[model samples]
Target: MTHSDTDTLRAIQHTERERFIASHPRSMALARDAQQHYLFGVPLHWMRDWPSPATLFVAQAQGATLTCADGVGYADFCLGDTGAMFGHSPPALAHAIGEQAARGLTCMLPATNAAVVGGLLSKTFGLPMWQMALSASDANRFVLRWARAITARPQLLVFDGCYHGAVDDTLVDMDPLTGGTLPRASVLGQVHNHAAFTRVVPFNDLPALETALKQGDVACLLAEPALTNFGLVPPDTGFWEQARALCREHGALFVCDETHTVSTALGGYARAHRLDPDFMVVGKAVAGGLPCAVYGFTHDMAERMVQAKNAAPEGHSGIGTTLAGNALTLAVLQASLEHLHTAANYAKMLDLASVLEQGLRDRIAASGRPWTVTRLGARMELQFMSHTPRNAQDVRDHAQSELEAFTHLFMLNRGVLLTPFHSMMLVSPATTLNDVAQLLAVFDELLAALRALPARPATAPASRSA
Candidate 1:
């Protein structure tokens, strides 16, 4: 981007910020009050990451719409960053939660629905045995312990720019200079070097992955089918197939984290694509927005886990939480599996996402912007570059953070909400065509605003290999 582009983006961002503050008086007041007690004026520090002038306080959310405290209604394409990918408060899940509240919340024991949920998990995700946790982060952490225990290996492999939700082993980044793993710079309170046990490689790089796995010390290769945390860099054609084969050839377990990629299909990207991971984790939307996640594994892998446990000295495993698989979560999971994670619902989501993807592409073309859209079933990302990125390096090299901030703020000012971390849009089962149209209208308005700026020559498009 040129200096003129930067100036235009700043101008638009200023106007949008002002408009947002004016429209969200209630939210602004609440944010001011919260600042007296809450850190960063928010319950979670990351909640402050939104581009809004103040944190938008939610009054209510149902289906694909969110109403802020100031009575502003937004067509929410963020969907709680995939936590509500099936849509907020789906009737079945809401009902299940209500019923379970009266029965029992948690007793540190299995609920009546536990057996049934296990069967649903096995049938839906194509894995026979399973374990539960309070979040995908916890599940991923447990799976890493199990993989290391069973395989008796010390090292783990992960793709660069991957996020498996707060797991320490997955928090390291690739050192561009030496192609070695280094602790992520943004990570705080780190006392140990994660790179000692974690090897990082670029996504879609088969040779790098094969070389890493050939070291024979890797216990598991944990990855998403498509990287989501760093702006949705998808696997190349035949990437997972070859990666899976290489892991098997080198004795590393393949653990697919489908926390976000569950939006890809009824089961997940792993099931939809038949990647056949040794272990699979599904969270976020898995329990209908409840704080629950589950990890499943093959029968052979389960047997290995049992052997590892039996061979160990009896003690706390450091593998589960008290609230995980609680009665409330189990009931909600059953309802979500029966009602939300269906082929019919997924069909609707995919159709809507297809419409959204094409709509974005068409709008980008009309605006004459060198932007691109990448879609994975119900999820889509509007990137600032012309070509789809092959890896995290591609994204970092060409990222236009200022333009991205302007786009998000612009959309929010127009009663539309996108994922704040990136220009990601998710289509839920409850997302309607009208909601999509509202987003598109705002998007078009945003493009027109950009076009009205002083003319500047377009830069050459980046090469596909870039």
Candidate 2:
């Protein structure tokens, strides 16, 4: 972008910020009160990442809508960043939570419904053995430990710009200049070097993945079926097929982290596409917004896990937490599996998402903007570049920080909430055609507003950490 483009973006952002502040007096007041006790005026640091000047305090959230403390309602495309992918507080999950709460919460012992839930998980995910965790971060960490223990290997491999939650091993980035792993610069208080045991490679790069796996030291290749953190970069055609083969050929486990890509299909992208990973992790919306995650593995992998455990000294195996697999979470998980994770819900989500994807593509073309929309089942991303990115490097090369921030704030000001980290949107089963139409109308307004600005020739975007 040129100086004129930058000035115009900043000017629009200023107006949007002013509008937001004026309309959110209640939120502003709450934020002021919260700053006295809560760090960054929020419960979690990430809650402060939104472009709004003050944290938007929620009054209520249900279905696909969120109402802020200022009585402003929004079409919630963010959906708690996939934690509410099945829509906020589905009745089945809510009732299950209430019923389970009255019975028991956690007892550090298996719930009576544990065996039934296990059967549901195995039948749904096509994996015979399973484990539970409070979050996908914990699940990924435990999977890594198991993979390393069973294989007796020291290194793990992951794709560039992949996010498997807050797992330390998956946090390293692939250095573009050196083609080696480097500790992510933005991570705080990192004493240990994650790159020492984690090999990083670009997504959709078969040769790089093969070469890395051929090293024989890698225990597992942890990956999302499609890259979601940096942007929606889907794997190239036949990428997973060949990638899984290479892992098997090199004697490494292929672990698919479907936390985000769970939106891809009812059973997730791996099962829908027949990737058949050695292990799989699904979280976020798994229990209809409850704090639960489950990882599954093949029977062979289960046997290896047992053998590894039996061979080790019997103390703590460094896996799981006390709160995992609690009775409440299990009840909700069962309810979600029975009701939310169904063909009917997915059909509605996918149909509406197709309409949304086409609407975005049509608007972008009519506006003649150099933007592209990529879709995976019910999720879509409107990238600034003309082509869909294949890797994190591509995402970095086309990064438009100012434009992205402006888009998010502009939409938020218009009663639409997008994912704060990127130009991503998710279609939930609760989303309606009117909601999608409202979003498109606002998006059209955004396009027109940008079109009114001074035009400039595009330039290479400055590299920035995500």
Candidate 3:
């Protein structure tokens, strides 16, 4: 490692802290205004990630931009972290949802649209049978339960740093003190031992994964198509093929949670990559911002799941929700399948992602900084490390809070908004080349500002934590 690079980054962080505090008058005023009613001065706890005394209140948003309470607008590349990746209020979805809301929001009965939507899912994702839930978390929980019941296995395997939307078993990790995941105390109010059902392994490590499933107790391996939550760690070359082989060998189901990765193709990354998952869970953008998630199972697994469900007496099987597959959700899903999830939308988003990726790469390179960018179709993120990380620890270890604050705040001030927590941004179909150009201009300025700083001490000043 070169000494000069470290010095430059330190200097950048020093100036960033001071510069960030000095500006943000509008954001500061709004934060003070909001602290009166909301806990942690924000509605949701995580909104504090953006650079402000409190979270910036969003007034109005459309397509790829948001107007804050202070009346400043941002080229919103975050897109609600893929929930709005279909583009906020796309005309067809909005019209259909509005009509459905007027007709009926949720009825206990199934709608004809459900069959149509199911058919579309079958065509797009190659799954023979389908089920509905409120979110990806529910789908994962359902998948785990069904897998266990069908296989009569008691355990599951998951990769470290993989987030499947608050599924209970996924909460296990390398212990803070012991480095082996037992029941973690940080998971407040969780009464059961999650470690009893879960085995956590590092990504791209086949030996580790095989070891976990070799016991033949893991019912399934729940994972993202490519781990995106740990800041876009693409699977190592040949990682997926080996992982698939091991699952076959170990009698564990391969469940791909494409909740965040549905942006990659008309179906998802799974279909695009020819991943023949026994079960698939996707949410976030499927129903055009509605609280709906759906899952599909292969024909063989579908029969088993049906039999397992039929064996259970009706009323609270722990897998069904009243609001799931409601008339409104079905209508919205049908509309989204007809409009948003089309080939044209995928093409548009992919083109925009390429532009954003190229711009970030060029800007980062010009600054002479040792950082990298990762792209997963419409989703792109800039990570402050020279190379992509291999596992959860690598990602956490390489995290640079001061630099992240600097980058996010700098972008916020200049009318561009990235996702609050990390350098992640999703290019929506509504996003334009002009928005991309403006972001590049602003990012260029921020990089130049960082470059101008004289190297400071290695220790960076304290700031907000992610």
Q: Estimate, for each residue in 1-466, the C-alpha lDDT of model 1 and write its tens digit.
A: 6777778778878988999988889999999999999999999888988888999999999999999999999999999999999999999998998999999999999987789999999988889999999999999999999999999999999988888988888888899899899998888898898889999999999999989999899999999999988878888999988999999999999999999999888889999899999999999899888998999999999899999999989999888987888889999999999999999999999999999999999998877788899999999999988889999888887777777778999999889999999999999989999999999999999888888553333343332210
Report the lDDT tens digits of candidate 3 across residue range 1-466.
Answer: 2346556656665665565445556667778887899887888777876754346677888888888777788898888878899888888988998899888888798987777888988987778799999988898888888899999998888887778877778876765454456654446689887777788888888888888889988899989978787778888888898899899999999999999888778899889988889999989898878888999998899788889888888867778788889998899899888888889988999998998899889877767777889888988889878788788767776776766777887787788888876789898889999999999999888777765553232233223232
**C-alpha lDDT (0 to 100) for residue 107 of candidate 2:** 96
Better of 1 and 2 by TM-score: 2
Candidate 2 regions with alpha-carbon error over 4 angstroms:
454-466
Candidate 1 TM-score to native: 0.97
Clashing pairs in 3: none
Model 2 lDDT per residue over 63-120, tens place: 9999999999999999999999999999998899889999999999999999999999
Clashing pairs in 2: none
Ranked by lDDT from best down, the candidates are 2, 1, 3
lDDT of 3: 0.81
Q: Which consecutive 10 residues in model 2 have the weakest lDDT in total?
A: 454-463
* Alpha carbon RMSD to native, model 2: 1.2
